[model samples]
Target: MKGKNKHNKLKPIMKKSMLAALSLGIALPVAGSLPHALAGAIEPTINISRPVLNDDIYWLSHSSEQVDALPIMPSMPIGVDNNTIIIDLSTHFSSDRFTQLGAISENTNVARAYVTNDNKLVVVPYRSGKINIQLQAKNALSPEGEMIRDNIELYISKKGDLNGDDKVDSADAVQLYNYLRNMVTRRGFSYVEKNQADVDRNGEPELADMNALLSGYANQSLGAKDNSYVLTFKQVDDAPYALNGKLNGDLKVGATLTSNIEFFDPDGDTPRSMLYQWYRGSEASGEGKTEIIGATEAVYKITAAEQEKYLFLQVTPQSYSSDRPQGNPVVLRSESTVAVKQEDIVSLSPSNGSTEVKTNAPLVITYNRPVKINMNSFSSIIIRNLTSNQIEANYIFFLGNNFRANDNKVIIDNPGLKYGANYSIEVSNDAIIAADPDDNAYMQGTVVEQNGVQWTFTTQIPQ
Candidate 1:
């Protein structure tokens, strides 16, 4: 059970390499029925054929020519010399199973495998390089569990062999760069294949990986370089605004706004990539905001609908410094207010001179632009019951009592007008009607005067 468990655990880890080896006919044979002489008087020995790289088989962006299997003689007698096998393999996994952290050949320095009791052999490469595959077995003439051993060598290519030409050069760097920039969408390469360009092993191929290749290609040519470096990225926050032109403050509807990051690299001298996202909301703050779709560029145009709304720009910076693999982008949010011409109630409830209104009906007011009101000054605005010669405060709501204010307009609960009463709601210039202070159209002491800002309505019979 222990052996079975270990095999199961290692099988998945070896699936990729195993598939390549199997396709190439290099996998070991099962020990189900060993040489007939094993149980006979003659001792049986195991002999394996040397594996040769075909080099003719090729696949998308890689060569499928790895030694897949080694022919073995299960019934051969002992005393035959075992041959040395050499496999020139690339670091790209035959299958994606090489995606694990320890699967890189440069890390493990060798491949590993074990001979199963059933005469089967399993191999897994820890890292690309000269790896040894050792097998153990015992002849029937010896103890029941006694065994002989042999080893095979596997030479893995260095990382950054992007083109699989067995060399790391400017070509690999160009491929990696184009891929990162999204220029090569159908490169016929799988995820693992592209990962080979992560020469610095920073989890992904970025600017630093390209730099590593360019910096180490000479050493690689000399057969002394591994194209490995400590992947590190410094933490970078949203950069300050460069204020290329004017930013923030008041922007009129239909006007254009442009801005960008100040462009300072935390690595002191390295260049970093930056992106932008624009948001729209009612407040200068980002709460209750929505991203402006397709608003990723630095320049933005204010729409008439955006009047009285706030536009916030968030800048994100990306870095591909090998020393900063764990580094994350920092975001900075800046804002501008869209100034709209002062707006007032473009429309009102209970149309002026309206009669037969329900005693309980609410007064609704709608505006072209959102407005602000100072409920404290409600007293100055009155609804007079002219039929009864009484102030609205005498029978209806008082200051701070029955009015609701929103961005665009206000709603007032029924003043409980007596049935058949004629009432006139008046607003002097002193009435507290104004656009929110945050709005561009906001003014101090006047309500919208479309119809002189006063209206009279008569209540229907009490129901």
Candidate 2:
């Protein structure tokens, strides 16, 4: 059979027998008796041939006598330095003869496989590392099946070693910085080089890497091309740093809650990003707390309802560097703020100790009065699989319709619960809760010790 792609040309498909050879994991001669040779005469012979690349495409082919042989392997290793290699089907057989093409990479994150319009296989590398790629071709001819196959290696460069000088010192750091700043122009680096220069490995070469390099120098620990950036410490919590600011104070009903929870890094490295979340709860112990809607600023106002309520702050500081890879951003979280007097939970969904709850039911908590929430504090509310002791829900903080400030209600979304499973929703002291800003009695409540709340129920069995 023949087929046409964007190139508008006929392509032959490989016989089914060839694809079968691939599944068997070893190349052997196609099923057929060898031609009888004349007495004392040498018999004609053929071997499986390896695929070749032309014009960035890969090509494959095999002789009739070579049907059982495996596809030829690449002559050399391939890597991020030389990732784009091709294998064109038209080279070994007519495009019309092959129907399916398959390719596999040992490490998907490091390399990818692509087929071109003209039926050529293309291998692309994404990072500075080594990966293996394999290719296979199949056709409908002969239900017995036959396949053509090939394999190749790929390699990406070390992170931060843009010049390939085998070192990640001030020279590489300066070069990367200048490149990002467009100070000069030259062309020894390839796609893999920029990836290597991305010291922070955040998919871009940025100033965070420079600052990390500088900090590393100060600590006498700058070095290496490993996937994870090496640092004297992975997070600020281990560093000799301080958290400063107006973390705790009293406020009048009409005044703003003073905010000043700041993280001080002793090495003075700039953070790639910083996050702040304020929480309010009924007790000074921070139980029954919820995130304050849009309270992400370094400071928050003390609304009327928050007048007498206790408040605390939470801050997350992050920094990026060659030592701190993208997926593993260096982060340090501050302890929860001092729990302050807050609002109360007047009603809870599933009625606390209720049983036979629906699997898809939502968890709801209603306050006695209008209340505000601290979004990040939702982490303190854990939904665990009582039988497995596994927490099944991942709380995503969003101030959508799920939360109604006017009604003083907060709804916790559950991803999914198992049928007939016993589950527990435990609210810890860290969850935030606060009264509405319009209330005049906000400051009238005495500071209370709201320990926390926990409820359990069994889900109905699935039909």
Best-fitting candidate, measured by TM-score?
A: 2
lDDT of 1 by residue, 42-111 (tens): 1121112111111111211111222232122111111112321222221212112211111112223344
lDDT of each: 0.43, 0.45
Give candidate 2's whole-model lDDT. Answer: 0.45
lDDT of 2 by residue, 1-463 (tens): 1111111111222344323323432222232222211112111211101111111112221111111222442212111122244445454434565556777777877557766666666665444445666655664442423454444444344344455544555565556555554412333433334445456544444445555544443344444312222100001111211133344333433234544433333222345445667766556666676677888766565654453455656666554423321212121222333334444567668776687889889787676666555554444446789888898864433433333344566667776789888888765433444564433223211112345345678888877
**What TM-score, computed on C-alpha atoms, does each candidate reach?**
0.24, 0.25
Top candidate, metric lDDT = 2
Q: In model 2, where do residues sit more than 4 Å from their true spots?
A: 1-343, 376-381, 398-406, 427-431, 438-453
Name the regions of candidate 1 deviating beyond 4 angstroms: 1-343, 375-379, 394-399, 430-436, 440-453
Candidate 2 scores a C-alpha RMSD against the true structure in Å of: 28.5
Lowest-sum lDDT 10-residue window in model 2 = 1-10
